[model samples]
Target: MTGERDNNGVVGVGADLDSLFAEVEALRELASDSDKARDSARVYDFGIRWGALLSGRLQRLAHYHHRGELTPHEQARYEKLRTELRDVQPLAERLGIARPTIPLEDRR
Candidate 1:
C-alpha cells in the first residue's frame, strides 16, 4: 500500500522531508512577517531577498516538491530560494531576525 497522503495528496514525507518543509515555512513566515512589520515594527533582513522568501512562493515550492512535480522553471525556483536564503541568512540575523539552523533543502 502507498503510505499516508498529505492534505494535497502527497505521499507520506519522511522526517527529513518534513523538516525541509518546516525550515522553508519558518523562513517564509519570517520574511512575510518582516515585510508586514517593515512599515511599523523593525524588519531585520533587507532587499528583494525578503520578498523572494515570501510564504506564498515557498508554499508553492513545498507543494510542488510534495507532489514530486517540478517543472524546469520550478526546479530553478527551488534551487534559487535555497541558495538565496543561505546567502542572506547571516545578514538577516545580523540585521535582527533569529533564524533556525534547519535548511530549506533536505538531503535525499
Candidate 2:
C-alpha cells in the first residue's frame, strides 16, 4: 500500500508531475513552429523568461536514503515534511501516496 499506487492501484502525484514534464516538452516544440511561432513566442517569452520549477518539492512516497543516512538539514526537512504531511495525507492517499505506520529508522 505504500508506493506510487494505492491499494486500489490509482496512480499518484508522480504521474501528474510526469504529465507536466510532457506538457513542457510540447510547449517547447510548439515554440519552434514557424507559422504560429508568434503565438508560441508570446507564451514562451513570458513563461520561460524564468526557468521552470522542478517537481523535486513533492515528498510523497519519497525516500531520503543516501547511503543509509540523512544529513542534518535533510533530517530536519524530513521531520518538518512528515509533520506537514499529516494534514494532507488523507488527500494524498486518494492520489496513491502513503506513509508507513512505523518510522523508517525503527523499521530497520
Candidate 3:
C-alpha cells in the first residue's frame, strides 16, 4: 500500500481491501506449511509443490472475490478453484470461508 496509486487512489476498488491482504498472507503461510510437511517426509515432488502453490493462489483469489475486486485472471482462476473446493468438502470446511461465485457479467 506504499506505491504510486492511480487516479482511484489504490490499484482498484476492493470492498474488503484490508482483510484481503491479511488473508493472502495467511494463504502463503498455509502453502509454506504444506511444502514443509511434504519435504519433511521426503515426499516432496514438483506436482505436490505446485498444488500447494495453486492452493495458496486460490485462497488469495477467493479473498479478492470476497472483496469484490478480482481481476480478469483472478476471476478465471476462481471458477476452477470453486469447482475443486466443492469436490473437497472437508478441505472447504477447514478453510472456514466460502469460495467465490463468478460475477454475472463474467459468466458464459
Candidate 3 residue lDDT tens string, 63-92: 556665556554554555455444443432
- Tens digits of per-residue lDDT, candidate 1, 1-108, equal 233555534333333234444555555555566455454333534324444434434554566666666555445555665675676576556445544343566688
Error of 1 at 12 (Å): 24
Model 2 per-residue lDDT tens digits across residues 34-105: 554455455455345212322232333243333223445444555554454354344334323233342434
The clash count of every prediction, one per candidate, is 0, 0, 0
Better of 1 and 3 by lDDT: 1
Candidate 2, number of clashes: 0
Give the local distance difference test score of model 1.
Answer: 0.50
Find the candidate with the highest TM-score and give its number: 1
lDDT of 2: 0.40
In model 2, the worst 10-residue window by lDDT is 49-58
List RMSD in Å for every model shown: 9.6, 14.8, 10.3
Model 1 CA deviation exceeding 4 Å by range: 1-54, 98-102
For model 3, give the 10-residue run with minimal summed lDDT. Answer: 97-106
Better of 2 and 3 by lDDT: 3
Question: How high is the lDDT of residue 80 in model 3?
Answer: 51
In candidate 3, which residue ranges exceed 4 Å CA deviation?
Answer: 1-43, 71-77, 88-108
